[model samples]
Target: MYEDFASTLAATMWTDFDETPEREGPTAEITDIDSFVIDGNFPWTIITLETDQGVTGIGEAYPSPGVHEIVTDYLRPVLVGENPLDVERLYNLMRESLSGRGSQWGVGTIAISGVEIALWDAAGKILDQPIYQLLGGKTRDEVRVYADCHAGEAMVSSAEEGQEETTYEPEAYARAARLAVEDGFDAVKFDLDVPSGRDIDTLSRHFDPPEIEHKRSVVEAVTEEVGDDAEVAVDLHWNFSPETAERLCEAIEPYDLAWVEDPLPPENTDAMRELKRSTNVTLLTGENRYGRHGFRDLIEEQAVDFLAPDVPKTGGIAETKKIADMAEAYYQALIPHNIGSPVATVATAHVGATVPNFVALEYHAREVPWWDDLVARDDPLIQNGRLTVPDGPGLGIELDWDVVDEHRKTRS
Candidate 1:
């Protein structure tokens, strides 16, 4: 299917290029590409693409190791000297050039995703338009966001020493949900894979009866605490077997969760389909998946209720829009999984605004106090748990290089 789509798209591009007249002056070309790793709740890999025309665009890769290296060492070669305005062409170029590597998935796609976002940003600025306008047009002025509340209190990264671990008590979950609701989020999510009191074998991926009851207690407490104030979702982090996932889904069916995310591992579509059939809970998983091809089976089989592709990890702006288009055909909602800085968040918003089936974008940095500080905008990017799609050129936000430098992680 993708091959046919690519062939059609290539033919269209060739026709468009053939009809175009030759330009007189110098064209905007990519001059250099650089990447940085910032130490936040996670190590965020940020990329910057500079054009010969003096327009520089910024982007963020999903938090992961070696993303910066992949960007500088691999993707940079294909991107430099190319026209950043030809975003789709350049994106395909990057992928095809790295076919021998892991470009189809993993850190390879992650690095390319960041550079691809930077290309769009640069292209938007070069064309004096917002990314949504470039894609098609806006479906709405604002994009809804869901707060990723994690567990009790704010979670401290494991890199931070001498910090107390998050509590897993049901009351703690309730308190966290209440806090998110009071902070003006209409929707919230928490981790359901936290440690339960009883565990016979952690590696077995099977939940004992007592463990199931404990998870149920947490879900019940959170729902009861929030009541009608907010909708809730839970993330299992792909830590359970299909049988355990079915049991967990059945136990929480009465709580009216918005969705159960990544209940089982992402690779097994057959198992995911079976689990979805056996339960009434809404299922959403795609953050681990990459690009439109990565989500083909999940959408075609109707394995889950929602598609949650992480923009930076999946395939950046243009690629995610393609993924969303595919989901729309199947009547699925696009709730992007976001864990990067404001760069990726706003980029995802641009795509969200253009897609009709966009439900909401995830805001995973509520715990990162300086998250908003990373952007150089006068107003906060997120207000009342929603993002107003930027009308300014490109991604509609600028980076505070000073803040970026402060948070940058130094490698030995």
Candidate 2:
């Protein structure tokens, strides 16, 4: 068991900065990305787990400011000397061990998530096989993917570098969707919300009309181009109320949409179920969900037609698999929500490939050019819109330490 293997899990904080700018494709031109990322300071605190038998696993927590102290001060002690293989035991122990109530949903989940992921990585390393192979020996070889071509432009300079030129109009969006299909992707997801708001932080945003109109127009354009052959998804970023979402769904119902993602806030299953009951369009939610327990209410109640959980935020591999299984029991499709680094994408691909009931994975269509450089691999694992799982043990691909070191932000 992971609990008994003393050397199985160990954690260290690793930060990698973007050598290039991470762009927004069709979303808002909010100032938050600038306020936080102007200095090329994309700080992600990653944890590494090593086993007594000389195997290692890598996992990431929710990247945030001050993440180093949070990991070192709080999570490291709980994991430093524990067995990496005893995954379930450690998960339960850490759940009780963390401070404060409802810690499992916020930073607390993030802390334990890193530990759990590292353990999974270590287990794969120990078994000398890829992570998916260890997880019931991959049911499918390739994981289907959808291009999130919503990447507008890399924030290489400042947001004030003569203000961004709006190139991603409705025509441009449709063209991009076509190009994604040309490149072998069978599906694509585009955000139909205008990049409005002055203070567009992660959780808060002020509504604007021009932005919404622009977003709706963009969606209309993409729908015109892609037609029905491809699986097209639209993400609302939890901006609308149920009524607004319903109206939007009715407006776009003519497009034969594959799904409407995160139409309303994720926590409100009743609202989602209500919307689902009303809309002929497929309703989707669950990007902000945590664990299996967290998803149980949504699943049992039949909140939405699709379940999209992020890998890193939802307690890593094992917990995400469980969530998928639960979704399967309910006959809900599993479309993972991923919008981060390559490691997170690969981890998500593992789960998606092995699981029986899967829809598709999200990738920053515009971000590939920017994010591909971060990894050491030559060609990306993606081929023809399907990511071929790596053959090596653990997560398979290794981060370019030199590249990471060069772009590493000093914790000052």
Candidate 3:
């Protein structure tokens, strides 16, 4: 039965394979693509592509409004009936087809990213190879992960109407760091851009002296709490002005942070470069950016010490691997910014495993209890502070659809 399916698929999909030397083996045509929105800590957008050969591949898009529509309405037309095995070719096709419809950046690229990941996943399953192996093999067996403990249980997004206000005290930050360290993560991060009780003007994006001191105190507390047990990093969330960012960097420099992330907004690479010049603390950015073109200036201008491209947002696996390659040429490390489900996390890990410059992958769902339950695995995907790269075909993990349906949200 399997041989019959493969032969039928190849006959229908690879009529031109004999004419092209580079094309070989059986090909599976994508029959349908679907997406689901799970209401987890964040709205996790999961994608699946069905193939003619009875294979289905799963992927995750960076969560955003209208991602489901973008995937089904826009991208589905371009993907159905195409060869899923032609990963890069299909990726470029999607980009070129959406040229003016915001494919270069924003949610359009994000939707395409999810579909592209599905393509890779389907391709891997068809070829009976893991994604890392298809990406040229692994550099390490395990990928290091950093827990994004957002300012002592304070949600990165705004609090609910009836929820208690999140405290921005140093003690809270310290306790958060301690808990993460106790959980076996050797690297942890907290938000430094939280309410400092001394904000003169947040809309102006300026940090007054008192606010700077408050942020510095929080950093000191976390660093002191973790000590040698873990490396501490803080996120500025692109919330401050360049001058204020410089002051904040200067204040935290004494603690020897792993990296201070996104001090300034994503628009100005020149400002980021100047901020890098002004601070001794390691700077990390690129989560807001997309694709190699989006990250070109950051890499070429030497803007930051580390690049944190969100895999599901920045053109999926192949595109991110290309970005890492570009960053590698300039000696910058890849520490991907991930706020995704286990699907996106494991997909990003595949890229992390293959890249020579991968430093660590960000884990943002520590606060979500059912994060590990979303995947069908006996053991947790992440053990201690590291995730062992899966050697099984494709992503090496499957979604627990029962959990997904339980948490699934209605599309708006």
Which numbered prediction scores highest in lDDT against the true structure? 3
lDDT of each: 0.85, 0.67, 0.86
Residues 1-412 of candidate 3 have per-residue lDDT tens digits of 4334333443444344412225567777889999988998888898999999899999999988888877776667666788888887777667766668778999989999999888888888899999999999999999999999886454423223353434778876777777788888999988888876653778899867888888888888888888999999989898999889988888889999999999999999999999999889999999999999999999999999999999999999999999999999999999999999999999999999999999999999887878999888889999999999988889988888898899999865
Ranking by TM-score: 3, 1, 2
Point out the higher-scoring one by lDDT: 2 or 3: 3
Global lDDT for candidate 2?
Answer: 0.67
> Can you tell me which runs of candidate 1 are displaced by over 4 Å?
1-26, 152-166
Worst 10-residue lDDT window, candidate 2: 29-38
How should the candidates be ordered by lDDT, best one leading? 3, 1, 2
Name the candidate, 1 or 2, with the larger lDDT value.
1
For residues 108-222, write the lDDT of model 2, one tens digit per residue: 6866776677666776676577888878878888788887765354321212345444555566567667777787877887766545333444344333445455666777887
Q: Candidate 3: where is the Cα deviation over 4 Å?
A: 1-24, 152-166
Assess candidate 1 and give its lDDT.
0.85
Candidate 3 accuracy as lDDT = 0.86
Q: Extract clashing residue pairs from model 1.
A: none
